[model samples]
Target: MSDSDLYATHTVENQPQVLLPYNLWSADRMLVHAVQQNHSDLPTSTLTDFGNIAGDQLMNAGELANKNKPHFQPFDRYGRRIDNVEFHPAYHELMGEAMTAQVHAYSWKNESTTGSHVIRAALLFMHSQADAGTTCPLTMTHAGVAALRNAPDLPRYWADKVISGEYDPRSIPASQKRGITLGMGMTEKQGGSDVRRNTTRADIQADGSYRITGHKFFFSAPMCDAHLILAQSTKGLSCFLLPRILEDGSLNHVRIQRLKDKLGDWSNASSEVEFQGATAHLVGEEGRGVPVIIDMVSLTRLDCMIGSTSLMRQALVQALHHTQHREAFGAKLIEQPLMKNVLADLTLEVAASLALTMRVARAVDLAKANQHEAHLSRIATAIGKYWICKRTPAFVNEAQECLGGIGYVEENILPRLYRQAPLNSIWEGSANVQCLDVLRALRKEPEAINALFVELQKAVGKNSAYDKHIENLKAAFDEQETLEIRSRLLVEQMALALQGALLLNADDKDMAEAFCLARLGKQQGLVFGTLPASVPFDEIIQRGKLEN
Candidate 1:
């Protein structure tokens, strides 16, 4: 046979099409509407600009960062222990974009506004779609501001650095820079989430600074200028600010042991560190470290929720884009009835996540303003974190499968998304941690439970399916013994109930009906593509598309 004659079938180019110009905010009607209803004060112009950045330059840099994972340089050429974790230029470029977009410091920049939490959450959600790692530094910085204000004298110098929108990546003192970043050093080798079990001890010096002499197994954002760490002081566990560079412009005694070898989040560096009497400043009142750090944890957990939501959205968008382009069995994959059901089902998940998360963000804004929404957020945050993050991996995996074998390859973002999916649930807090927190919320702040119910009750007559879900949730709540033993089940129930409430309250009755029917009414199987034939596959699929 001639060279070109025998392999003619291979010559047909079966290229998978790329998804572009996907304005992360505008693409999701659910997200935009939620922002409008909750944070109307946020300038529409700002959101539009962010949407453009996320879909364009930042989106492109995301792929570049992951493609060139961070590498650790343990020592300098002169054999000094520098322990620098070097990233590609794209990583720094993304960092600059995030800072310029003001996602890292926006809430702090406009803390007095009603849109403080809402805009920050929006920027966070959109940016995480582009780059997951750099967001951690921004998160730490945002959380650090709250912790810093707790200091008796207030560390104005350091706190001001974080709030500044100038994105300086240099390793130097805050005094010499236009802006800076913050990291966290909480977890140690002894305990993961149990910061109280941390053995790092802080000794007070004559100048009122501290000498921290312990190790942090997971020191976030190694490039940051300072870290907020929990260490045992004279009174008890206290919050301390550990600066990388001291006032004298000398490198602090803290030693970066090594960079973590992790499954995902390649763009940012996490390190195991040792503090050899490194100088630090006490942040909050001595021994009130947990509450002070808890302030930070609260916001960080919200960031984690948004992180997972963005991952799921990106994965679904890619799957939707690919299936719309690729053909199989003499038709485009997206046109197949079964595929429509699957895509529509995934759409509901993404929409519900956005709705529920934004609602919680609105509550955060209210809480800051001394509104009753604080009571609701106390409980909702835990439930949202647990259920949403847990739901993410399965959604991402199935969405990846929608693209067939191409989804498994390293070149595509799907594989990276698959790797990053579980990081949110595991980081900040794990499944059991979040579940236990939910259980704690149910017991301690019963008012929060009441608020959740009140929110759900608004949709009582909207849909029979949703009404049934609310009733089932109440019934489950009454069974305290069962709830205690199976907190995950109870928490999951609470989350779905809230989502149902949001959807039913939403103007889009069709999507709401489909979600309630698939998740609450029908006895669907434990997989995607299980939407009942009674559901409007065409309407749901059309509404789900991120592309116009």
Candidate 2:
């Protein structure tokens, strides 16, 4: 055969074997290790199963679903105004797998487990490893639990159904579904993060359900049985639960304006919707919309941090896989000193991110029983949401560059991962918003600051580098005059200090030292692979191996 005839054979030889069965969390390392270190009783079997679904089944589904993105349907062929978002079979298949994994409602079902939130974080991190669109609704549902409690009647009403490990996508009332998914519509066009400026109005009705008449600029997963929305009332901004189907078995007056042409996250539907006196149930008090929804927003913000971290880990793993297999300069790529440095630093960066994020997750799991944990979770989520998400885009791009041309193409997941990276930082809330939230927490809730400091203080004496970073962060807090001007700077310092503290407390002394030197010690440059030459590169890189 001619050289061209060997195309298929040649392609096979160069392609790297993928790490599957959720190799990222197949072992109790990194984030999982951090979780087990604190919560020793987390079921080992559940972790293994989650790893299989994410690394194997979900990963396969992710590959196909992203290839076949969802489409918006304005009307049915019979001229019926059935606004629906049509996704490829693979997308639904992936959603089904994710729901079966109970990514949405598992934490609620396992509410008795002390490590429930950490387990949820692990599952969410693993599940989103493939596709993130479906994870959004699940996250909304999970978060909805916290906000749902405000409406005392909602618990018995939604508890069993929301906690059901089933993915019923029927456009029917929540009562009729085998299981139900949840969504949220908060931001409108005029106000992206400034939800207080939302002009949507809600009028009380005789039947107890309010009539919401306005538009939501961005409504995710429109097919969800219900969405918790925000609108203006006589009492000011309030939260309302808007269902797709009203009690009379008729579609609510939710007129789909159009679907958003988002930059990435193609597997889910984000729509612009108009409610013409739509039937909605009031969720908390009349004017407590922002305060009520803040619970849900905080959870989604945590999801954003997890999502960004997942993207970075995937990119790093893919880079590691390619470097280990592909060859150049008469040697294997992994053997190349330059590439090894980059991978090792990436490994440390991702590990530190996972540690800090999981620390928040642990606090979340323990929060219901302990107010201190809750306060720590509140502040940790804000700091992580800002720093980790902001770092994702650059980290993904660096990982992509490691693969050169191949990573830039659609054939590999890097391009898709890169495109998906920015959405997390932008989603739920933007970086600036999170930084300000950190500032707000410090200003209004001194308890939260103390909570955060308590957590950071855990690693204070372990390492001078980490302790110094914490001191720097404390000094920034003291400078209230320039706090706003240096808000981002201060948040960055706080986040880094927190991550540094977590690493310093971690069992992996080498990885911790490397992280402090590269990140906190200022011994590295702006880009990856800038770890100091004296650092032990082999142990760090090997620890990052997907198989390990």
Candidate 3:
């Protein structure tokens, strides 16, 4: 079957189905374009080179996945894209590279609005393909690995151009570039988090393909191009790489009858997908799908952590800018001692979140480079995802406090960021679920924790503030005698300290120190059953000044 025929047939067959409102899609596209333009910067030739490679691959894959763009009319009941879909780095190759540069550029002028738009565009494209049943070739499993490895071939076609450090972002037209979108069809409505109980059946067809029949309730990015779907194949509970489009690049049997009215990420279309014998291809071996999918989930969860941290960083930046500029009671808001403390605390939190995110990213990179133990990669990925995902929302909320009334306003980005922040923790895996996984890994491989501790000890040896935090963490670990209690507390404290250290190590050393000290003080108060009677507030203040 030709790709065009397949698309036409699928569209005709699904014509009766409700089409996504076009205005919504247009509004979203407009917002993305505006943001991208607002944030445009001189491309980092080096990063652009890397991006070109990935971009070329995506372009080829997208072309091969020939699908129609579904209209997205951005409007609420009252006709508005109030909850605009913020762009991300994950989708656009150029934008992703741009984000990497932004992190390292250290030039305020390098900050551009385009990165977010590229992400949003990719997400929208995914949604459109999901609605159309076009196969998503940009499998999250391989994509995650590619991202971490910074493999030029992984992003494929544009590899040499991107890696050559001479690619131009402007040369790539927005219309030609595919947008970023994700697929979520993992939850078994009956079994909840237990994939083993998933009864969704996939029977091998005569043509070597499988027909999947079942219902998935909590599917996110259901309308995306590719979905890492879970099902019961012949081997056991497994994952399948199901695309909205078929191999010929046409809509498959997937159907999206309803759109979710989400609490956040509203612009990103999410829906409950019903597969009435949807066509699918088995990923890896049959029974290995679940583990493979879990691996993908771990990496995604890590990305979610970075995303959350990014949100917090953006929120903090906005809040600080507001406070510094906005005056009340005849003084700038930041000048107030209480506000100062709030800003200080927020700064610490944001810094910590950034450090933790970088640490996880590096760990992911290291694991990819070594290619030694899948188990180790899995554990490290889980740890990174769980720790940062849990902390990002908290940081955002605290930062929001700095914005005061403005934070609550819909127009102010904080409220949107705050609402979106919580989704990361819930998605990939919940906090409790991740904690249990951590405990399981620790119990199964005690050496993972020990190895991590050894690394932490090395970090503590440094004279930086993170070293002090590690020292305090070690003190706490040593103080506990009970195996069970100590293990639990140690995990919690270590997660915090490790994240602090990672953040410090990756992005900003000075900010990391400030954050580590702040965390140490907060933790000391909680763990020791009393706040320091006389916190060396002056010392902390002095340290903060020196760091800043």
> Residue 280 in candidate 1 has what lDDT?
91
What lDDT would candidate 3 get against the real structure?
0.49
Worst 10 residues of 2 by lDDT: 19-28
lDDT by residue for model 2 over 396-441, one digit each (tens)?
A: 9989988898889998789889889999888888888888898898
Question: Where in model 2 is the C-alpha error above 4 Å?
Answer: 1-24
Q: 1-548, model 1: which lDDT tens digit per residue?
A: 98779767765455565666667777776567767757766677777788888888888898899888889887789998776778999898888888887888788788777778888888888899898877888888888888888886745767787777888877777789888888999999998998889899999999888899989999988878888999999899999888887777778888888888889998889999999999998887899899999888888888888889989888888888898888888898999989988998898898889888888888887886654588788888988999899999899999989988889998788998999998989988898999988888778888878888888888899888888887777787766777778888888888888898888887888888888888888657888889888888778777667756
Clashes of 3: 40
TM match of model 2 to true structure: 0.96
Could you arrange the candidates by lDDT from highest to lowest?
A: 1, 2, 3
Give candidate 1's root-mean-square deviation (CA, Å): 2.0
Q: After superposition, how far is residue 456 of candidate 2 from its true place, in Å?
A: 1.9
In model 1, residue pairs whose N, Cα or C atoms come closer than 3 Å (at least 3 residues apart or on different chains), thus clashing, are none
For each candidate, give its TM-score against the true structure. Answer: 0.96, 0.96, 0.64
